[model samples]
Target: MTAHQNGTIATEVSHFLLNCFVRSPSWQLWLSLPLSLLFLLAMGANATLLVTIWLEASLHQPMYYLLSLLSLLDMVLCLTVIPKVLAIFWFDLRAISFSACFLQMFIMNCFFAMESCTFMVMAYDRYVAICHPLRYPSIITDQFVTKAAIFILARNVLFTLPIPILSSRLHYCGRNVIENCICANMSVSRLSYDDITINRLYQFALSWTLLGSDLILIFASYTLILRAMLRLKAEGAVAKALSTCGSHFILILFFSTVLLVFIFTLLVKKKVSPDVPVLLNVLHHVIPAALNPIVYGVRTQEIKQGIQRWLKKGW
Candidate 1:
């Protein structure tokens, strides 16, 4: 029998069931293999990137510092969502405690926003490096990175803290099934019988405002960068500029594209299989985590050289 509550507040409900593709039990068994592999790859790649940046003196630049921070965020974000998901797939451990669910939701919201902010800052870093080469050192100092770090953390935390807190206060009223692998804001908020329009509207407004602003700024930075490149007569200058910015651009492109796809899937949820959104949601967390390091390792000369040196030393 399912749990029931008489009052408006559903405080009696201790946990919520994460209905991660319950209709297709057998398919989960097969899906678990790839998910597990992806998780491992995401972990290994991001860890390698972090350690490489830390150990290599040559990579001690503002650009690499931001990349290292990106790797850290990617790793934490992947860890936050994927382990519980894999547990659900492998062990049928679908019940998440109320507090744990809220925590997961908080981390996902904050870190994802932080990642977007980091990308915008990184775009600025590239812009300064390419467009104003002589002023790069003075412009992107260690103090600037510290300020940017504070901004990313403070902006995201302050904006997103309300989401989980608001969800926690609502009356669940005994409907505890979240039909997704991860604890999302709407997933939790929708369970409330009370008015959730405020929560939903705030979430929508905050998400677009933060991400949209970052996207606009990043696009403008890159545009100016391209314009600066165009003014240069030497082909070598253009190639050098592209080489430096290419990895960051590619990763941001993938990240933004997948997120857009996820949003589109949400808009057209009725037309597609329910599994599609779930799968996309899960992939959005892991795919970018796995790709960021690999793109940097291959496309980034400094990181590639650092990896080779680290391999030689066998650490």
Candidate 2:
């Protein structure tokens, strides 16, 4: 494309962005401040957790290693989604080009799907630690993690790739403005002139196949873990089991609650208020990423000690 063609695209993008979410309630002005604060806190806390984990040798255990991966994913997930969202809130610039929007969707889904995979792996980790203690190392080998990570990456790529590519091909002359604070899958879908039958069907299948299967496995693992704990005769053994598994429990709760809201709202709610989706988006991304680090850093003794030692050394 010529510079002139590029300029035209830029102008259209600017216009689309300016008008995007313009119909949102003025209450966004009030909400954005608090959300920004939370986002900042989440970023800072998650970063500290990741740094402490990386710096400390004692946290090289399997569970902490997984937690560190989660912390990294958490931070990256927020970094991928939140700044653009904040930009939309602060500047009202939402005119993401078709290509640009698809890129965002692709990256977001990739990290998020990786996160889902991590959660399932985490549940299995807890199960092995608690129920099948002797087999933990052999079951969750280095080869297993490498294979699992590759599998997760491949699934995410396959799942979200079509949504954006299919979406980019659809022409949008009507409803130029995006209703949500950020360019979401559904929001972009809403603006399309083409029938979304295939897209919706894929969405359903991917959710049920990947997410549903993961959730089922999670429940199965947890059941075994709980049963083993109940059978434990010693308090110290229970404490150790809980110590290793406890962080995962918090993680499960955090993910199930936050992501469910977004998933349900996306699937069921039509004509959702612009601000509501934005708020959900913020919570789904920022809060979890930020909270994960803080929860682990504060609750995990080794991480706490590591942070203190670093500080002491600095001082």
- Please give me the total number of clashing residue pairs in predicted model 2: 3
Tens digits of per-residue lDDT for model 1 on 146-185?
Answer: 8999999999999999999988988776788998889998
Best by TM-score: 1
Question: How does candidate 1 score on lDDT?
Answer: 0.91
* Candidate models: Cα lDDT each: 0.91, 0.73
lDDT, candidate 2, residue 283? 75
TM-score of 1: 0.95
Instruction: Give the alpha carbon lDDT tens digit for every residue of 145-231 in model 2.
Output: 777677777877877788678766655643467766555676677775568877778767876787788899998998888889889
The alpha-carbon deviation from the true structure for residue 129 of candidate 2, after best TM-score superposition, in angstroms, is 0.8
Cα error, residue 111 of model 1, in Å, equals 0.2
Which stretches of candidate 2 lie above 4 Å from their native place? 1-21, 263-274
